[model samples]
Target chain A: MNIEIKDLRFTYPTGLEALKGISLSVNAGEQVAIVGQNGAGKTTLVRHFNGLLRPSAGSVWIGDWDTSKYSVAKLASRVGYVFQNPDEQLFSRDVLTEVAFGPKNLGYEKDKVDALVKRALSLTELNDQTETNPYDLSPTWRKMVALASIIAMDTPIVIFDEPTTGQDAVNVARIANVIAELKKEGKTVITITHDIDFCAENFERVIALSKGEVLLDGPAREVLGQEEILAQTYVDPPQLTRLGKMLGLKATVINQEEFLNALK
Target chain B: MAFVNFQNVTYKYPLTKTPVLKNINLQVNEGEFIAVMGPNGAGKSTLCYALAGFVPHFFKGEISGEIEVDGKKSSESTLDEWVLNVGLAFQNPFNQISGAKYTVFEEIAFGLENIGVPRNEMKDRVDEAMALTGIRDLADRSPYSLSGGQQQRVALTSILVMRPRLLVLDEPTSQMDPIGTREVFGVVRKMAEEGMTVVMVEHKVEWIAHFADRVIALNEGQVLMEGKPNEVLTADLLPEKGFGISRYTSVARQAQQQGLWKQKQLPVTLFEAAEGFTSKGGGGSN
Candidate 1:
């Protein structure tokens, strides 16, 4: 599942033009991360891919299917969205049930749903809490349950909204591993996040959005190396990148390995 | 007595089997800025509520232990009276917004109104608070129309306008961008400098390292470690206990294992990490 948008524009019912004319494309099985300040039209753009919001102008094509012709439910089978707030979407009593709900809703067979739910739960390290009430778990665990719920859908495209927010380092590592697993399975992963470090390490492509426009879109190193543009969007480069800059390293370094290698 | 003291404090929510906070003993001095760090369900937020007099007062929980703030006992004072000295701003800015008010300025003044602040004085205080948080231009905008970061600033300004002696913030910048986070931190730093005590719960280890006077690592409702920011944040056992240590510290530790880093102390901030890695006998430029 590829996503293509051309001259996309959106206006809320309150007369707020959230997204100006914008254009972008995501290749199938590609991992991309969208970053910007709060209310910078990142959410407005992603909502179009899943048909949650109709484009006021222009067109969004999900693998040649124009989003305008499809309802949100119709798009759900192709695109799975894990909301930023897990509480908003979590309605089931236990973890296993919550994970099973998505596949069941998509008309999967009982055995298939059971298999997918087990796989997702194991991947997210939530297998131990399968029978536990989701609300009884900590917010971090609840976030994992939410991710497992979406993963069980087995969509080719998965979209995560600020998945690392409010998570500790360990939980953040877990989310990154999940994304890696999703990519390994040949699924396209798109994340809108404030965690620049996570984005630097995991994503191949980084899109910086500012005020309903694409500020920069390129490889992770190139896009994140432009600190001035990122400053305009209120994003700082990853810690290692900043460290590399401070050390007068000739190249941009994103993680500890690169930082040490650059030092050598 | 210290400005704030918690003596063998433990609390459990209504009908809960286990206590969320267990035998937590701590103390804070006046005008000191303390940052509390912990994993989820570690009782950091409960500690904030105890400081702000909401744990037992608002929630009506089973609390055993003594909490003192500025010579007042938490269990003895009414919630209405306790809030006058200790103001709290939490994670969700939307939940903190007072829907009764039309504009940001009026929304900030709503707190003062509830506590019966005089009309003339309320206007002056509200303006001052707005100026402090850099939200003066948002005075006339509807509180509901502002962005999440902007609304968080307004929520903070509402509490600051009350002129509380102590401010308790729980991940107040989670919804903010880098610039917004810095803006809120700048305001909080200024308040601490001006003799207002503060206890903030945050996950951004880098920011906390720069601003906090002390760091407390909480785990499973207990204080796992407490001391200067540098000592607690760079502790070897932080990661094992599920505390969110700085990435710089982790990276430096890894480099040390590879025989690349020579610093005696691991770095918690980017500046420190860079200096340690670039200084004499260190890795880079060797």
Candidate 2:
């Protein structure tokens, strides 16, 4: 589903203006990454999609549904948000139950829920830990459980908030593969990430928010290559991109393959 | 004998089939900044806890071996005493906050207050620590009101204010933005230079390569390898062992096969990769 925001403005109860008047649209099946420093309103902005937070002076539309009109639980079928901290969203007793909870909450048939859970388990590489308690697992594995739960939801739009944070290299690769799978399935994936390399690799479109304003929004290559502008939001281009610029390559390289291709 | 030593160290939690940390022998010198790398469940955090006196003292585990730092054995020192010399900032910064304090400044000074530091000295130290981590602007903000990156900084500042002899950080910058991360590395690197021994578990090899004096690769509760960052980070065995090699190093490895990279040693950071890729008889692209 497409996400449309018009002049989004948000203010905390504490009188902090988290997001200023900003507007953007994410098309259906578009893999977009939002990059910015802390307190730049990245999280505050995305929270509006699933109705976790309401805009003080704007509108957020999840396709045809007005976000403000829908409760967070009601929006679950449309937008699956995997919180930054698994501990915050996870409460299931076992891996199987946790992964199955989302689909069940959306009132899917038991068979469909089971199938989705199985797919999510396999995709997140948590198959063996189905019976194990998520809290008993290491933090990294717990993150996978959180991911599987959201994936099992099978929403049209999936949001990952710093999915790569605290993940090891292998886990990171697994997360990237999950994103690739989501893209292949033609699902809309929106991620808020600080790992620029991961963002550049897995996301095609990039949106940079700087203190409640849209700093840059474009293709990953174009958006990420603007070192100075990205720096304003406390982001650096992927390592390969910076290296490409430093080497005076003909074009910017955002990933390893592009770097190698540029080298040749 | 080294300043920090782990000799035949083996540890298991209260409930577990196998030991999380197998027999491990490692040593670190004074002021040395050692970066530890490994995949999930590699016992990297266990090692950090062992060094910080949490393995046996707090976690209530079965431990067989010695962890010595600054000539004081971990077994002999209580957690309270151990924390004085060793300050640890784990991956989850949320757990580090002392909810007793409201503002970031007061939260950072919580440790000092605990140890009876003079109020004036406590303020100065907290200020200095916040300045080091580039969180001075967050002084008045409620500790709970900050972002993840800001909370991580506050957690780190809390630890830094104590001025521990051995600093243990587990993915301290995991929640930080690029700028916050860079500033953290800078602060930790400077602390290491000032004779503070550091053992950090981190996945950011690029930053580790730039600042660490040594790197230790861990797997299945054992030290897989330990050497200079370039050697350990670029080792071919790292990937097979479930460790993530830097993108530059992996690209270089592939380029070497296709005759696009020329350096005999693989690059771990972008600068080295750029040099090797652009040197004479290097990449024919640029």
> Residue by residue across A1-264, what tens digits does model 2's lDDT show?
789999999999878899999999999999999999988998888899999999999899999999989999999999999999999988988999889888998999999999999999999998899999999999888888999999999999999999999887888999999999999999999999999999988899999999999999999999999999888988988988998898898898898888888878
Find the candidate with the highest lDDT and give its number: 2
List per-prediction Cα lDDT, in the order shown: 0.90, 0.91
Query: Comparing chain B with the reference, what is the TM-score for each candidate?
Result: 0.97, 0.98
* Model 1 lDDT at residue A70: 91
Across A61-80, the per-residue lDDT of candidate 1 in tens digits comes to 99878999998988989999
Most DockQ-accurate candidate: 2
lDDT of 1 at A161: 89
- Candidate 2 whole-model C-alpha lDDT, 0 to 1: 0.91
Interface RMSD of each: 1.9, 1.2
- Give per-residue CA lDDT, model 1, range B158-262, as digits (tens): 999998999999888876888888888878988999999999999999999999999999999899999999999999989998887777999999889887789
DockQ of predicted candidate 2:
0.82
DockQ of each: 0.60, 0.82
In model 2, the Cα lDDT at residue B97 comes to 94
Candidate 2: which stretches are off by over 4 Å? none
